[model samples]
Target: MDRLERVLKGKLEDSPGASCYWWMGNWRGRGDLADLVLKSRRVLEESGFREGMRLGILMPNCPMVLALSIACWSLGGAVAPMNARSGAEALLRTISILDLHGVAYVEDRPEIGEALSRAGMPSAPCGLEGPLRPFTGRGASELDDPDTAVVFSTSGTTGLPKAVPISHGNILNNVTSSIEHVEFLRPGEVMLNALPNFHTLGYSVSGILPLVGDIAQAILPSFVPADSALSAINAAKVTGIVAVPTMLSMLMGAVLRGGERPEGVSFIISGGDKLNVDMDRRCQELLGAPILEGYGLTECSPVVSINPSYDSRRLGTVGTMIRGYEHQIRDLEGNLLDDASEGVLWLKGPSITRGYFRDPVNTAARFKDGWFDTGDVVRIQDGYITVLDRATDIIIVGGFNVYPQEVEMALMEHPAVSQAVAVGESNSMTGQVVKAFVVLKEGQEASPRPDNRLRQGEAGAFQGAPKGGHPKGAAPVQHRQGEPQSA
Candidate 1:
């Protein structure tokens, strides 16, 4: 068992009175779900998977997913997580790298299946029957697995997606400190897992740390129908809801539409994209709290810096570094700039990813001695860091992270999408919502009716075209006034 799993098991064992909870879609209100975890542990052992090099999970935040994650890591295996929302080609690209003998798909999403099939990975339906026996031997897996179960890459949308290896030691440093800072496990704390399990935010909060820390995560396939979000806040009595500006806007809309936000919600930590100031103020007025933003990349275990839950709720800034990190702003000369000076963000700490798998050239380029250059430019003022536009076109929605490349890839996968480029556009609610600029195949023309058109074979999609040969899923196109951006 890893440090956190051991700590949680010990903690839960020590305090039998302590309770945990989760959401079961139609089943409303938080209730005890710890028994399911215990059963999963026993069932996983019975399912013939006690020890392994590593086990990969690409699932939504289902109850079984939560249970199976705890069960697998408890025995051994690093619990490598991949995003279920990734494009088929992107998913296949990863499978080709991991020499894994097996894979588990939690939901029946055709996208996951299509991607796996395209990748030639014959994944079986994920079963909750991973077998386990009491192993007397101490920590069979190294605290950090150089070759054990681990995350394969950072968010793949930017550059060539590089595999980032994380060890048990790394996991402990990040989450243990996180719970301490956020007080997530303490009584009266509730979180909404609107973020997917594949990304770092999802992996840490939804997949791993919840039960281990004795907190509740309201899991949904995806956050939508803005009004329902507000109802969730009031009904769930959510304390610390981690979302991006988009989700906050949705919730705010819900509140204005008679959606009640109970006083129980104490903190709202917004990150995974640039924080919008206007949206923050609206939320503060409606939801009765300020929006706190943070900044981090997947390579940093996704928590490089976050706003302090109680004291510092800077509206435009992504707060300061977390308890132990050194967040820096550097000029082009590679010299660290003093506070308030805008420059590229550089971070270094125990949380830094080991390196990219099989790509040493880029790895050396990205790392400077110990600090990793965060391509995003940021300015720090009064200990609050304000993140500007990305060094690239990655945009985050409602705290569930998104990248233009990923969205573009999806649009291109549609049969009619001849070319697509997703960009961040202004919205009072979501800070930034993904806007796609599409070019059609030879016969297609841009249409006003987006929903009325055929989703599969209308404007952007073309089949079996080699990469770059067609304009599909191209990189970001900067826009000037009165011009529509294109791939």
Candidate 2:
């Protein structure tokens, strides 16, 4: 049997009467989950989805989505989860790229139906609103692990998203290693899962981790209207939460806007993007728990490193590498660098994926020998790693290199600035220069220049700063999301 199938069967045999999932104001026991998986597996098999077939799941966060994912894998098929928030064109492009056999989405999204019709594909209904069919299945001895258990969509910040296929061994090993590191999830501790299932953080951490461990999860339809998320936590008396940096920021914004912070929240696990240090402190103040910042990518089964919730965690680093994972620092030429040296981060572990699905060019470029080039510039000290920036986000100023993160951090030092994103603006004389955009705090005025102590002393001087006048023919500084622009 595959590792996932064994886990499912164990949940059925060992904890049949224990609650496995808490969603939509109800609790589902393991026996109920096991029966649902069996019926769901039969439904998929009868619909012609069998071993090695690809089934796309386009659904919101709910109990059935989790069960269906397990059912597809239990039958030795691969599940490709689609992000519901992605545009139809992008979703269609992904569908074409992956060559999905069939799709199952929650309820009827006309856009999904239209896209499927255009692609000439069929889909099935997989939701919890209706009664589940009854079916019988074989023993664990009959099932073997498929090559890939789940496929996730890349964030595609730089370009087109690639399909990342994670094997059963990849995710199972990662989950085991994570459990060893964060061994504080007491039984019956409820986790508020607001992240989407399509992403790795949502699937592996929130969805699968709970199944393997003794925790119950409360699902949120989406991470908007922050009050709703808080309400879910209160209703479940949740002690843990998984959220991205932006989601936490929004929730804190709602809290500051007179929303009450729910009780029993023990810690907030933050990932998906870099967590600002200032916001991290504020989140702790609001949520009454420590904000454990983390770093990961879809290729690494979503998590390569994370801070331990119950340990002494370094504020600025993504904790020590989880057990069984080995990492190294390397220069641009791939030569190994010593500890504490800043360079590219290369990781090798059982949890790391084999490569991107069916993309040979990218696979060759990303994986060398057994090590995967994470494409991130980082500084490793002792066993802790600090991510500096994406190699692509660096800007060249004359002969020197400036990281956008450093510029953004410098801008965020000001009390007036609430958020910041730095981008490279092209310069004829000096290859590229840094331009920063920042959101202002309420009733705060914009400052044309940051304090010298904050920017010049720590990050060095901003190269190509406007001297007598702005660079001739320089593009006007652009603000993002309608925020005020300043250079």
Candidate 3:
């Protein structure tokens, strides 16, 4: 049997009385959770959920979400986690794409029911109150298969969501390796998991890691209402928080407005995107814990590397690769580059998924000789990875390359700007140039010439402007004036 199946079954058999989850003001033991999972598995099997079939989970971050997913897998079927925020069209497309047999949801929304009916998909209620069943034998056959454990939905730059199938081996490798490498939390500590369970970050870190490691998980339905998250942290005595940059910023805002800081927080892990330096520093100060930023993608099952909790961590770089993973930098010509040279990042490891669910052409283009092209430009020095920007987002101006992230970071340094996006525009002389659109903070007024309003050193790549108060070979467009900013 695969490690995932063995670990889960062992947990139920050995330590069934241990508290495994804290949700809705109650704690549930491993035995209860295991029973719930088995019952759900029975329900699916009785409803004709056979091996190789896929079940869609339309729930958010709750214990049932994890239960349903594991149950589906235990029954020799895969689970497809559908985004709660997906529209009807997107939902229909995903349902059709995966050929989902049934979808489990908390609430019976008429629209979702109608969409499923139109697509001929069945729906199941998200409930754990069911009759207990005799424990079945280990699902060795399904667990041994190293493909299609979970069909994860990834919203690419431009398209409907792409379904990425992560195998049992892939997630098991990532979760177990990350816990051993990062050492973020101990078994008894509570983990506040407010990130949505549909995303890989949420599923692997917040859902599966806590379960397999025997840590207590306090799950929230959503990340909004920072006060609720803070309360859960305080009430549960949470020791670890897994969140994105925006969630950290919002929590910091709540603390600034008189919300109490969570005591005994061992560490806060930031992922899904790069953590802003300003937000990182402020959140560390506010939460009284170091914010360790990691890097990953949906295709990576989805943690590639994370800062070690017990060692010295680099402030700006995603720490060394996890156990059993390898990385290399490749140039535009597909030639490998030495450490410290910027190029497209390619990763090879057991945790990496084989390919996109049903897109053979894109899959062939992404993978070359078993190495998956990450599409992000990065540099590796001294075993640390510093992500620069996407390969497609690089701007070449006058033969000099510029990454939009650099320009965006520079723009954000200005006190008046709250958010910024830098894009590359065609230029006859320079090949391409950087065009930035920025949003002003509340009550912050911009001068007629934005170039003049920028602080010294704030225009990193655009400092060499020739005329028109803009970068040479570039055109600047003002998208918005002073706008209301959300906390």
Candidate 4:
């Protein structure tokens, strides 16, 4: 058996009756999960699946998603989890690029079926409950790397989604190092897995880490309808939560509106985006847990570093890099910089993938001699990493670097602002200028002098700009109170 299969099989034998996961309002035992894996494997085999094939999955977080992943590994195949909410054209493009042998998607979505048909791909309908149907596509195996366990989809710099194939060893190293670094993820404690499984952070940290670490997981289809997420937390008596900043903000909003704070939550792990300072403070006060913000990317099997504990954590920094990884700082011209200097991050380690799946051109552009360019500009001091902004997201105003996160942080200090996203807008004088989109908290109104309010926020945060005036050649900050921000 492969390494992943061996570990899971051992867990199944060691804890037959222990609660493995809570889904659909019930806690299922390890033995029950094992049975599902076996059944799933049988179904795959019947559909002509074999070693060295790739299986595509388009579904939310559920038992079948986990079961199919394990089943694929047991048969020496890699599983590709795609976003279920993607548009039909995007899904079709991804399917064509992946060259999947077969696909399993939610039964209710007809658009997915149409995409599969257009791609001439084999597919089957899947659900949270019920036996999986055999795939109808003619499965011709192509993948030959037995070490590959999962092929995660990430949006490339060119705007199309690229496939990242993560090896079993890559994931195992990440999980082991993460468990050792965190120190507080004790076995038997329940973790809430509400992030979509299609996301690399959701797949590795929230979905698979709990299983390998002997920690029970509470699964939700998605972190929507905050009531459902809160119910899962209380029902499972969850002790840990892995979420992005948006999810944390939503949960905090729910709690403020008379929802009970989840009991026994030890700590919240925030990744995938910068955790807002105001939201972090509100979470501690209302939800009664410290938010341990971390840094990661999909190419590195999802996790690179995280704040180890509440007491040892530095509020604005992503804690020390985990074991088995080496990092370097490089300037815009690709010259190596001193540790204390700020630049883009380059990573090399056992946990990092070799390259993007079957895309040598893009992979060559990003990876150099085994070192992957993370494209995130960061500063390292005393072994702690403080992410400033994406190298691409930085705006240049009068030859001054304007980091969007700093602007967003300043905007969030306003009482009425709930969330904010800052982007670079084109300017003729300066290369680019800052344009912010603000989301107001419920029942909160924007200030009448919005331009003055933005000027105050920017003036306090950025010293390069004059006190009472806007940044040089910069346009007035734009505000949209109730509009949704695109992901």
Local distance difference test scores for all models: 0.59, 0.70, 0.71, 0.79
Give per-residue CA lDDT, model 1, range 58-171, as digits (tens): 665566555555556676755566765454455555655554434566544445545555555545454332222222212223234432435645445353456777666666
Report the Cα lDDT for candidate 3.
Answer: 0.71
Worst 10 residues of 4 by lDDT: 457-466
354-436 in candidate 2: lDDT tens per residue? 88877777788789999999888998776777888766554544323344554555456556567777677766434466676
Tens digit of per-residue lDDT, candidate 4, span 34-106:
9999998999988888887889898888888888999989998889998654444456667777778789988
- Which tens-of-lDDT digit does each residue in 1-487 have in candidate 3? 3846557888877988888887777777888878878778887777777677787877767777777777877766788887644445455666677767677765634455555656666775554333322222222223323346888875433344467898888888898888888876568778887887777888888888888788888877876688877887887788898887667777888899988888878888887665556666777689868778788877898888878863668878887788878878889878988866889999899999888877776688788899999888888878888888766544555423345555555566677788877777766434466777778888876676665434222532212323346544355635475452221
What's the best-to-worst order under lDDT?
4, 3, 2, 1
Residue pairs clashing, model 3: none
The TM-score values for the models, in the order shown, are 0.76, 0.77, 0.77, 0.81
Task: Give the poorly placed runs of model 3, Cα more than 4 Å off.
Answer: 1-3, 128-147, 155-160, 392-487
Best by TM-score: 4
Root-mean-square deviation (CA) per prediction: 6.8, 12.1, 11.8, 11.1
lDDT of 4: 0.79
Model 1 stretches with alpha carbons more than 4 Å out: 25-52, 107-120, 126-160, 182-185, 333-340, 397-401, 407-429, 433-487
